[model samples]
Target: MTNLPKIGKPATNALNTINITTLEQVAQLDEHNLAKLHGMGPKAIGILKEALLEQGLSFSQLDEDLKNVKFTVLGDLKCDNAPKRRIIRDIVIASIVGDEKCLTEWLTDDLV
Candidate 1:
């Protein structure tokens, strides 16, 4: 969501804490749940909804057979284990693709 023009660091950090770490994830969340996240305020929610609308989408459209979106990771973490690499790869792909259920199934630790 950092790409969203009006969202500030606080709101971005808040969403990140809950593992809502992708723009696709933001679009999949209901406004009610989005409001409940500690750092999400009314203004942020409005900004998010408007951003989603600009994509020709809304929160409700996450289930519309959307494919996994491709993105490049820009960090120094190295994964030598093939299995772990694949798992991380799949989850990242799912996050990009707006696979809420897949993300939920795999990354449930520390979720609120």
Candidate 2:
């Protein structure tokens, strides 16, 4: 399994303050609900989004990557504010390119 990003104190505190702790909970929140939290500003939301991306996860795309299977970020090609779509595209490209093994190695490398 991929290592989940460390939820920093600020983010954790913000989540606790808003009573959101699990991935499922994060997945359930809409932008409006997230914006309602005390310390979860736009920047914090972006950080959380990045964390999810690093784990090959997103609120809407979580179902695509099953826990029983392994996956990795072969590439992250997207402009700003479109991480979810970028992930989806990259995953599709990975499948088509048949580079899952290389992706797994790259992801396992600490340099990546």
Q: Which candidate wins on lDDT?
A: 1
Alpha carbon lDDT of each predicted model: 0.66, 0.57
Cα lDDT tens digits, model 1, 1-112, are 4355467788887777766666677766656556666677888878888888787657744333432323233222354568767778778878767799989888987754
Summarize candidate 2's per-residue lDDT along 12-94 as a digit string, tens digits: 67677655666655765554446555566777777667866666666544333333334323222434468756656655666
Root-mean-square deviation of Cα positions for candidate 1 versus the true structure, in angstroms? 10.5
Those runs of model 2 whose alpha carbons end farther than 4 Å from true positions after fitting are 1-10, 60-112
TM-score of 2: 0.39
Off by over 4 Å in 1: 61-112
Model 2: which ten-residue window has the lowest total lDDT?
67-76
TM-scores for all candidates: the values are: 0.48, 0.39
